[model samples]
Target: MRLFRSLDYATDADPNWAGSLLADGTLPSFRGGYVGISALRNSDVLTAVSIIAGDVARFPMIVEDKAKETIVPLENVEYLLNTKVNGRLSAYQWRFAMTVNAILTGNSYSRIVRDPLTNEPSMLEFYAPSQTEVDTTDPNHVVYRFTPYNSGYTIVCQQEDVLHWKFFSYDTFTGRSPLLSLGDEIKLQEQGIGTLKSFFGGGLKGSVLKAKGKLSADARKKMREDFERAQSGAASGAPVVVDDTVEYQPLEVDTSVLNLITSNNYSTSQIAKALRVPAYRLAQNSPNQSVKQLSDDYIVNDMPFYFEPITTEAEMKLLDDEQRHKFKIEFDTSKVSGPSVQDVASMKTNGIIVGNEARQKLGMKSIDNPDMNRLESNLNTIWLDQRAAYQAAKAATKGGDAHEGNSHDDNAD
Candidate 1:
């Protein structure tokens, strides 16, 4: 009832928690330092994130006028993106791959590298900085350093000259990787997986052997060799009864191994939630959740938030005054979720979109017919029959009244 009554939740008052309260966020990692993007690939959850990001990044980003809602190309931004980014990666690959890497590591960098002779920037060069250092003296100036792929040396550059994109940052300026949030659990899971594998794979601790008699170190090594010799591709790793020089008694830790496996499987959902993805999408089943609902959640929540930081940063850093006024970049979410059956029916019934439009969206070619663009007359004639009958009766009555006046005038004459 009084959860927020005090900020001090723990009585132990560990410095870590106290420090987090004052600091914007804390860096958490499986090791002493930050987990590299390459290292995160070892995780199933992180792999799923890359898959999801690929799906999102394939959807083309179009420049449009906010007022007209029509596509506008500003200085070949769309064309440049289509061919390649900074002349290194295709638009699709760069946007999607970099976004996935950014979500996992909370870092993406692009610089406005200019031609030497001209002051204007000729092209953009994107870099994935392995590490960055901020000059405390000047808040605006920060440095990014990373090694080029297959290069022996590291390249260092300034942040002001680069376009920085990130996700899940506590402070808007510096993004923190969401992987760090579950770093402790991930480390535990990593160890658990290793332990389970070792137990099954006849690793060092496969079993605790109890020998019958005092054996020399040479005898013990021979016994291990025989055990491995018989265990290759076999259903079981039980020790072979050879010479009776040693008797092995295995540890009864089956229950512990089973529990660890179950926990690891269940944690798939936790990882999916942290990445803002539905568990079901990652091949993890969720009872009572339909495909449509999960797909809706994908477009509604996952995709937008995934692109929020990128769009915001690009708008602020990339756009000049004139371009900002006339053009803006947006991902067409229509690629993610199309109109549902009920939605399409409603749109058709209400004549909101024409037949050609619907057909085109449904992947069918348009028909060369006049009615394809317009709603059928029957759609607008639901109440017209009754209204027409009432109008006919009223018009007849007026005509009879006019004729009666003519007859009365003739009688007077």
Candidate 2:
């Protein structure tokens, strides 16, 4: 929400205090001591010292002799004074290290720019503190503050671009009070969070978007099938022909009639009849003309010309190969639908037309054939024969009784 714009070094009223630490004679003892003055003279060191001193004093120090006596009194001391100075310096150094470490370790604040034209968020810019510029407790190090350039507009950095920073009441320098130095600005720019001008485009803007789901299984399968078909068609060298014969014809009766015949898939006689032209005239005209000329004339004159001549040997071979391939494909497809002839013959001898259509129609179930009518006829024949035999046997049994009665009558005669 908050954006930073420019980075300027923290201003100092007496810049010499920061520079004097570098002089060998300024604090000879402190320079050669365990904690050398030069060691704490760095930008990070000065910033740390200043931060700890707050608004009270510019240089705070403490000196203890080997006898545990105060070597430099707090008030009378000219070069080194109290312990508060060292504490302020140390605190500034510590805080700077922490901030720089966080930035270096990818723990910095970042925001993305949205592209209004694309309606999408662009790239992000991150604020990264530099180790060299970081003085955790340095008061002399330059710290930035957001000031209103205009009455209502605050000048802030929006990813190195001069864009208004939205969603925040104040700028980056106004909130949280993070200590920064001149080196910090350099490091921040180096880490890709410098100024708004350095940013390529105002960072991410627009709207958040989501990706659509993957294609359906059936759609994928269809696409693959189409691809295979197209590859096969290309490999086979099949001619790419568009049937647009009618479009070339003129509006005149002859051309219109000829084009109509040629555009349709019709025989010569059918074409002649449809066009109201005599078949003999077509026959007479065909013998004297080349197929190309005939087709061109038919298309121009609107005549029906279905047959295309094989002009080249390559074309003829390609056509022949395509036809043979199609035939083989169809034959193989049909073979999978039925059993072999041997299986049919074996079933027939067993009084079972296993693959017969009639059996399937009658609902008689069989793995080889599903016909039902034939099964009904077979069952009817078997039942009729059984019934006839039963009747004949019953008649014979009655005949014996009849014969005995007849013999008694003969003796009486």
Best candidate, lDDT-wise?
A: 1
- For every model in order, what is the number of clashing pairs? 1, 51
- Evaluate residue 188 in candidate 1 and report its C-alpha lDDT on the 0 to 100 scale: 62
Deviation from native of the Cα of residue 376 in model 2, angstroms: 11
Model 2 sits at a Cα RMSD from the real structure of: 44.2
Q: How many pairs of residues collide in model 1?
A: 1
lDDT of model 1, residue 66: 73
> In the order shown, what is each candidate's alpha-carbon RMSD?
9.9, 44.2
Runs off by more than 4 Å, candidate 2:
1-256, 263-350, 354-395, 401-413
Model 2: worst 10 consecutive residues (lDDT sum): 305-314
Cα lDDT tens digits, model 1, 326-404, are 7777766653466765675567667777776666444344587888777643434446568988778889999999999
- For candidate 2, the clash count comes to 51
Residue 150's C-alpha lDDT in candidate 2?
A: 31
User: How far off is model 1, as Cα RMSD?
Assistant: 9.9
